[model samples]
Target: MTAKHAFHLALLVVFMMVAPARAEDLRAVMEADNARWLAAYNANTPAAFPAMYAKDAVLLPPGSQPVNGNEAIGKFWEARLKPGDKKDHTFEIVSIHQDGKYAYQVARWTVVVVKDAGERTRFSGNTVRIFERQPDGGWLTKVHIFNADK
Candidate 1:
């Protein structure tokens, strides 16, 4: 093989090796974002979600109409976050893929709800989120959808 061809093949090999590392990095970032969201939810407030979403973001909750924009999404969360509810929430991230300015996550979530009446229930669901890379090196949720496990 020509020296130039060998060099090009080596470069291609290196680039191919780096792609998985980049995806791993993106997964870490997405997991951190999930942690922040869980922290806010555990605090019994929907304060973090709207801020994490883009201005024109869309939320599709199961059995409900589509929620458009941050304001509506904020309200949707507000209605669900109870003041004194005890809940243990977790995210099971299945995959994360990134391309240029966009990244998407396929994940599952489980929550254990404990009410004041000692009623306990466990709920699990699947979630998908699409995030857009901001100019400031941050990510904003461009689309979010959740479906309860049957």
Candidate 2:
């Protein structure tokens, strides 16, 4: 092969090698999802939040019924947002695992809520979220399990 041909072939090979890193890299997907989740909660727009979830999504929230599907999950958040008030909130991702079209991630979170009687309630939890790659090249959450840490 000519030098020009060899150089072109080498560049093609390098591009192919880097395709997966850009296409399905788990870390980037997880980080983006984490940011979106934080934004959703801060916006207090639960109705619009479930659109990020897949059609068959399920949520296992601590101390409550298991919420299934986008509608149910959206309802849960809407109700929670209506509560007295919340503060001292924070969240961070712990880990992420990608397997083909599916992925799972863990996030640590904490929140403080104040009631009418001037009472303060503190809560901490870990959230495990499962995601699936959609046909349209987007990641949608499939399952979300929240467990209290204290």
Candidate 3:
């Protein structure tokens, strides 16, 4: 083989080895994002919740049409999260994959909510989320879709 060809092949091998390590690092970042999301939901502050999404993000909730943009997303969450309600959220990541500036996660989530009379409702679902790496070197959700496990 030509020396130049061997050099190129070595470079390719190095890139392939480094790629998986980078993906692992991204997985850690996504896990942190999931934790932040749960915290935001528990806090019951709609404003804080939408900050996890990109400015032009979209949310696809079951039995509903798509909601676009952070402002609209915040309003949607606010309507559902009343001031006096208590909510708990748990997320278990099934898988996370990344390609270039984009990554996606499949996770199972459970949420329990209690109302004024201690009436509790529980919902569990599987979710798929698409993330984009922002210019500021942070990750934000670009698309989020989830459905109930019922």
Stronger candidate by lDDT (1 vs 2):
1
Q: Work out the TM-score per prediction.
A: 0.94, 0.75, 0.85
Which pairs of residues clash in candidate 3, taking residues 3 or more apart in a chain or in different chains? none
**Candidate with the larger TM-score of 1 and 3:** 1
Residue runs of model 3 more than 4 Å from their true location after superposition: 1-20
Residues 33-65 of candidate 2 have per-residue lDDT tens digits of 777877677666677778988878998988888
How much does each candidate deviate from the true structure in C-alpha RMSD?
1.3, 4.2, 2.7
Q: Which scores greater on TM-score, model 1 or model 2?
A: 1
**Clash statistics: count for each candidate:** 0, 0, 0
- What is the TM-score of candidate 3? 0.85
Residue 112 displacement (Å), model 1:
0.7
Backbone clashes (count) for model 2: 0
**Candidate 2: lDDT of 63?**
87
From the highest TM-score down, the ranking of the candidates is 1, 3, 2
Which digits, one per residue and each the tens of the lDDT, describe model 1 over residues 12-67? 99999999899889988999999988887778778777998999999999999999
Model 3 lowest lDDT segment of ten: 40-49
After superposition, which runs of candidate 2 have C-alpha atoms over 4 Å from their true positions? 1-24, 83-88, 114-121
